[model samples]
Target chain A: MAESRGMFFKSAVVASYALMLAPVVMVIIISFFRQEIISFPPEGLTMQWYVNAWERREFARGFVTSLQVAAIATAIGVPLGTAAAYALARAKLPGREAISTLLLGPLAVPGVVAGTALYMFYLRAETWLDQDITATLSGLVAAHVLLTIPWTVRLVTASLQGMDRSAEEAAANLGARPPTVFMRVTLPMLRPGVVAAALFSFIQSFENLELTLLLVGPGRTTLPVAMLSYLEFRMDPTLAAVATVQILLVTAMMLITDRFVRLSRVI
Target chain B: MAALVLPAALLVFTLLVAPMALLARISLNHYSPTELMVEAFTAENYIRAVADPYYQQVLATTLGVAFLCTVLTVLLGFPAAYWLARMESNRKSIATILTLLPLLVGNVVRSAGWMALLGNEGGINAALRALHLTSGPLQLLYTPGAVIVGITAVVLPYMVLTLAAVIESIPRQAEEAAANLGATASTVFRRVVLPLSLPGVAAGSVLVFILCMNAYATPLLLGGPQFKMMAPAVYDQFVRGNNWPFGAALAFILLVATLVLTVIGSMALSRRYRG
Candidate 1:
């Protein structure tokens, strides 16, 4: 009786996972549907949507802009967040918990709220400096940088807490300076954690929409935002195609990321 | 040592702190259609948000959707999380990765999938028709039910992961002891595992509740234009109306509501656990 019960429970859990994954699987399957309106069972399969999505200039431009912003934001955010995480974990600074929460609080705040506030601030800053900030690349990347920091601080902090301190202590006893020790021994030990942080940071910045929506100018939209606007005009398999490509891109990156670091741990 | 923290300190403080302060200030000012905003010390924006029936309805809808999603994800998530927590390392890693994969994909992409699945001519309606379960396509999309499902899907992963981590810490012996004490399997779980998992339940609920309240893409894609929620309403003020002051006020209102609810939820759960 107990054996049968266990089997039943196992099957239920499997079914639940399947339900969670259904939308992703459906999106992939829909990408190849030949029908434009998207009916129940696809009558025929074709690669036409992929071609159509590729042909759209907005998607291509948006892809480039997203790549640039995500790259720059990750580049800047990872190191700064790494330093901050290091200090929080090791420095024993006053009000560490409060400071850490303050730094990581952006993750909890609604992106729409943050974006609106930033837009208004940029407008005011523009008036004061007699320069444009809103609807500009620099402005967009600045907001995205905010998106990247929390993840870096999180993953790096986890990495720091789990690390062995013997190596750092030994290096300190050997008369090596703090910078030299961090550069040589501590950083190399932290390679997996730092790499994972960078990868996830890039993904977060790239996929962000709520924060990026108000900040993008006429020509500077990100891919997710571009997908959204296109969605406004058309509801077809073209988005499925774009989304499938994104799924593939993210899967490939996750694969690469898993090789360097066990992403399941940090994520 | 403290110097290492300065770069991130400066980044957040300059960008987040300064901007949010400015936003808070703007929320107090008055919105002028022709002038954009006029600097005035008035409680009108907050007053308008509270007094307007439309906004009141929006707040209620947001709370309703968030509450339903929280309850659903927790009930649904607990079983899978328990299974995950008890799994072996070899199988667990694969399952864990599978669980986290959806989160890496943006919510927009996932919402497209839901849209296709729930649309009038989409798969579910088609299946129902083919099965002779319904004569016509049901109005599945653009409904409150659709929003609840979308938000639940988004937050389910968080709930599962958080619960699994917490449940993993509960020693297997605890369940064994309950069973050894002549309790049935279900009784052991009810009395032993359930109470021990309260912290995770509380944390996961708060986390999922906040996500549902601030859900932007899912509700917008699934709920259609007529259906209003806090996040979308916040955006509508800035984009469509070009009303910064009112938008700021709405945004602050949302932030406060989310924070207050989470605190209350945690307190309620903790109090129950203490007893």
Candidate 2:
């Protein structure tokens, strides 16, 4: 009886694995479906949806926009976050907990609420500055920068906690200047954390939708927003093809990330 | 060194704090079709939102759904979490990667995947028919149940990852000891594994519950427009209705409720499981 019950438990775990992978696996399979209506038996397989998704102007445009925004946001946010992380870990600054909480507060706020508030504030900013800001690329990049910062802080902080600071202390004791010690010693030691931070920062900014949804105006949609808009108008396999492409992209990066850093540690 | 923190502080302040402050102020003003918003100091938006039966039901439904999904994710998350925690080979890395894959896919994309699977003409219905399980396609999509399923799928990765981390810390010796004392399998689990894992359960539940409470994409995609949840309702008021004051009020209400309930739930869990 115990043996049978153990088998039952094992099967339940296997079944849970099925539940986790089923949808995305289904999505990958659906991408090749020849039928647009998505009926039973899946009609036949074709790569036409991939071609169609590729040819769509919105998706092409959205891909470039998402890339640029995610890149810029990561570049800008990661350095700032790394600096902040270092300062928090070593600076002995007052109200360290408070500062850390303030920096990470956006993670706690609902993305939609943040998006709506940012949109409204952009409107206020536009009128005050007498310039268009809400619908502009800069506005979107700013919003995505908020997305990037938290991931950078968290990953870098985790890596920092594990870091042996003795190298930095040795370099300092040997009479190296602060900048030299930081540049030559501190940075090389933080390579894994920095790389991991950049990877996740880019991923977070790239995959973000709810925060970017309202802020994205006409002709400035991110890939996820483009997919959402496409979803609103149609329910076809083209989206599956597009999603498969995304899954491939994210998985590739994650594999590359794991080559250098175990995400389980810092994640 | 503290000055190094200025750049990030300024960015967060500009983007999040200032905007939230603006939103709060706007929430106190009155909405006008003509002017978009007219400046006034009033609690009328909050009053109206609280007084409305429709908004109240939306809150209730959102709460009920969040609670239900939180419970489901914890229960379903345990067995997989245990497996993930206890695996003893290179395949453990593969399993971990597989678990992380869904999380890397955004909620919107995952919801789209779930949509295809749960639709009337989709895989589940197709299988049901092939098995002669039903005469017609079941009403799976565009239901509260569908939203719950999608939301659970979205947050389950987090719960699994969280529980697995905590469970990995627990020694196998406890379970072995219990079994050595002639305890039944169920008793060993009940007396050892379950109690030891309660903190993981509590943390994962609180985290998943918050994610569920503030969920926008899964609810919007799976529940269709007819079903109202707090996050989507806030979106509708602002985006579709152009009612900024009311939208801001709703947003604050959602935030407060999420925070309060999370605190209460975690406290209750820890208090009950002090053993």
- TM-score of the second chain in candidate 1: 0.98
- TM-scores, chain B, all models: 0.98, 0.96
lDDT of 2 by residue, A187-226 (tens): 8988999998898888888889878888888888899989
TM-score of chain A of 1: 0.93
Range of the 10 consecutive residues with the lowest summed lDDT in candidate 1 chain B: B89-98
Give per-residue CA lDDT, model 1, range B1-275, as digits (tens).
Answer: 87788888788888888889999999989887789889998889999999999999999999999999899888879889999889887788788777877877888888888888998998899999999999999998889888888888888899999999999999999999889989988788789999999999998999999999999998888898788999999999989988888889999999999999999999999999999
Lowest summed-lDDT stretch of 10 residues in model 2 chain B? Answer: B88-97
Check candidate 2 and list the clashing pairs: none
Docking class of 1: medium
Computed on alpha carbons, the lDDT of every model, listed in order, comes to: 0.87, 0.88
TM agreement with the true structure for every prediction: 0.96, 0.97
Residue range B1-275, candidate 2, lDDT tens digits:
78998899889999999999999999999988898889999999999999999999999999999999998888789989998888885777778889988888787678778888899999899999999999999999899999988888888999999999988888989888889999999998888888989999999998899899989878887897789899889988878899999999999899889999999999999998994
- DockQ, candidate 2, comes to 0.70
